[model samples]
Target: MMYKMQFPKIVLIIIITSTLAVNEIRFYPVEAIPDIKKVPEEYPTIQAAINAASPGDTIIVTHGTYNENLLVNKSISIIGENPATTIIDGGQRGNAINVVSSGVVISGFTIQNGTGGLPYSGISVSGCNFVVINNTVLRENYYGLQLTNSNNSQIFNNVIMNNMYAGIYIHDRCSNNAFFENTIKNNIVGVWSSNSPSNVFYHNNFINNTNQLQAFPPMILDNGSEGNYWSDCIGSDIDLDGVGDAPFAGDRYPLMGMFVNFTLRYGSQIYFLSIICNSTISNFHFDRSNGKISFDVLGSKDTVGFCRMASPLTIIKNYTVYINDKVPIYIGNWTVSNYIYGYFLYLHESEPQRVTVMLDLPKNENPQSLFPILVATLLIVTALTIIILIKRKGKLDKNLS
Candidate 1:
């Protein structure tokens, strides 16, 4: 009888442990803030919507042509409905859009017709830590996008063409800004900077521009990966490694093609193959044509690692993982499912490492299946708790008799 009572209590502990282990594995999804205001629906003009919006609010503009300059003084997202159909015409005024506050995001619009000079721009950002992406800044009287005294900003995926001066101008000691994947074409100068140190440029295509780059002080043109592509880079890839031989003096690894892809696998289940370098990981996808999954990575001489904690649904008995076609040094114990698996890698000759997982499974484990298992374990724990309490009460009544 004593053994029978102890059996229920032991079962209760096991069920509780299983339930806790399953609940501990969590995936962090990037949260999207809902749009609080819409232009022409909530307010008549774009500037009016901005005036009525509070900080962290998103103001989405519909597809139409609006002839007015915008001044953003708060942290908000001014998103256009479509990049081609949505237009913000400055009408030869000072600037198309001037951002004076930080943490602003301007995307999906065609900003044009600015008449102002040096300090004035199509999109002038005096604020730090902003994002200007997925826009077309064309026919500017001065600079297309100017960054003055701004630090830690990102300017990416924009088509900056037909500008009279530089496509992008960084000045006044602006540091740690990243310019990537932009098409700076048909401008007088692609990128011109003065006194701006530690700015990074990568993967941009400078096509048909009169001058490529003009700098007063030296900047980090490349981060040891393939730098921006120049139309006049007369270099040739003899070994066909997708890196140029030597047309531009400063660009050590000039890309032979427009883009490059890498492969990564997460412990038995997740795989990101043919992915672009330095991208973000959002999902486990196999097809790159669908363009659904990516990872945020960097390539350099320093060592780096990729880590993921195994969920309770995954059984980690004997796992084989590869990084850059080489086996990784596994550093943690894997007796249970809630263990962390990590692969430490050292860069070899300025290239990103590839990671792959080798799994010989009868069927792939589903991460979603853990929920039902957790529910069943919770029910078992509740049932065993009642059994243990009844057994103790019977023993007490026998002692009293």
Candidate 2:
């Protein structure tokens, strides 16, 4: 016999579950801020309204220019009416908007003319996981936008142009950030990374920049960059397919050549040698397709009895090699060394020594010559003399007994 459930108890449980679900889906509207305390109709500044806002409130900026450097240090959303009309100028001294607190969203405003020395930026989000979307950052004194040690941030649909350094720089422990659909142009570098990793970059257009993207110290393993349009790509499609026939080499850290040239005196020499050696041994290539750039690296060694060089070596085929790419290719060992001293020649001469080398044997050590027979006879006579001396000594001792 099954026990029957009470009808009132079942009805009470259903009512409680419905109420809990409704509470879980709560919506806070922009009007909620005005309800807590009525904002003055004619406030002098937007910062005053932000200071008066409570947690989870929205501060809507009217369609006008607010020449003030605002700081939002609370969990709130500051939405501007129009990105073009609503301008937030920093008087060229501090950040236009600094989001210090978490869960802040700054959308639909043009943040411009943020002036400071090197570290200051147009829109700086420090220690905050914020959404910076649909904004324009122009003529920043330093970086256009900078995220420091922040995680899970989204920077999308922003037009960042003419910045002094990188358009967007995510540096020093920033992780899991997403930069998508932004037009980053006319900056020193479109995007730069010092120690940041595990970030996703997609559908972004980098045009007319000195350098497109840069990553320092190189991404070793489990870290990669892909699926972004670069204007400087020059590979071809022989198959008429949209994708490139080959992938680009050194996509992630391709700026090493530029870095070396700027910093060292003889950096070009090193780069030329490196390219020749890598091309011969590694078969690396740089590919661009659908505006996305990436590197295609070849597999490990397959040749037996031949030890692979620690670094790559230059191998020229078909055409005569030139020293035009003027880089040194140093060949050596840990204890002793020899250099490949001459430049590559395109001579048509039929000199066999130019291609190979043969060793000459010493006359005393030649096994197939008459010197070996004479040496063997001398050794046999010397062995007989020693044996006879030993036998005579034994006979003399026996006679004396």
Candidate 3:
């Protein structure tokens, strides 16, 4: 670590002030220099856009039904205008979108109608790394997602249901892949993995499936803090921490409630964290200015509500929980994963209650919470000095006369 005395005072102050400045979150979007290719507007088809686009370009598909099987061979981002109306049907043919390139991001689309077979899916990946598939819908396909020899990929925030075979099929030594925050419902099998080892699965809801897993590989069902929520889980949360006691299949710490994920952007970096709550969590706010992460939790008056938080280690090193502006009697914490895990319970009412997580960053790095107080003290000192100077000048004028 570098010493602070070696740096200038003004530079350090600027860094701290701007790092957690009020109302500055999500302001500086990284505007890349890549060419943006619009579908049907610039190329008339998505395939045409890919054919003409260079690597690192972005293809934006507007709101409409597009009947085409896309094969992406270059590193690019394909974003739909909206997942509900941006439909990409494969006409009962091959895969809806086959990705042979790494660093690919496909989001906000409803991909369906692929041929009913293994390796043919709404989104198929082969030998790719750093690929992200999120904010999309995959239904009525042979496999909602198929990953072959893919590693370091993230699959989250997608409604993948009613598939013919499995919602996700992974094989051929797929390792280090993360599957989280997805709703895999009404499928023949939720996930089928063979010859794939060391793949992590968490924060996904497995509901109403004939078979949840038909596996031949070693998988981590939990992130050491909490696991995915299974509708048919036999385990129970005895300690009221929103985590199950016994193991369900392979998840030792299954979440009692559905996992909710939030994407927060500060400056150029994006931060991701998840919450497992019995209440309807909304109005989530991350105020680094005051070192408080606040949110509104709502539920019926008859039910008791609780929220389990999985805070990223990069965001805050420690935190305190406050419910409705009062500190609760008990708050549970887990020393499991690299991230900070904590939870608290509250009595539900007609109005939504506010919960806040007062953050404590690492030593000397978090220059927040005290900055405002220091500014106020500086203003007071300046005002007192001005008043004394004015009185002294008046007395000096009288003495001169």
Highest lDDT scorer: 3
- Cα error, candidate 1, residue 259 (Å): 3.3
Residues 1-401 of candidate 2: C-alpha lDDT, one tens digit per residue: 01113433544555555455334556876565322222235456778888888878777777777888888888877777778887788877777778788887777788777776546777887876655555654555477888888878877777888888888877887777887657688999888887877666654556678987787643221123233445676554343212234444344311110000011112122212111111112222221111111112122333111111111122111112112232223222221122121112122222211211111112233344555445555555554554566558657776888
Candidate 3: segments with Cα more than 4 A from true spot:
1-34, 116-119, 265-270, 280-301, 312-341, 347-401
TM-score versus the correct structure, for each prediction: 0.62, 0.50, 0.70
Error of 3 at 11 (Å): 22
Per-model CA lDDT versus the true structure: 0.67, 0.53, 0.84
Candidate of highest TM-score:
3
Please give the TM-score that candidate 3 achieves against the real structure.
0.70
| TM-score of decoy 1 | 0.62
Give a tens-digit lDDT track for model 1, residues 104-184.
899888888766543457888885675555555455647888888998888877889888788888899898999877878
True-vs-predicted CA distance for residue 42, candidate 1, Å: 1.2
Over 1-401, each residue of candidate 3 has an lDDT whose tens digit, in order, gives: 13224334534455555454433456667776799999989889999999998899999999999999999999999999999999999878889999999999999999998774444798899999999999999998899999999999999899999989999999998989999889999999999999987999988988888998888955889887678888788666778778888888878888787788877664445777678887878899887567678899888895767787776787667769998889865687765557777878778889988898887754544467568667655655655665566568768877999
lDDT of 1 at 242: 43
Task: Sort by lDDT, best first.
Answer: 3, 1, 2
Candidate 1 vs candidate 2: the lDDT winner is: 1
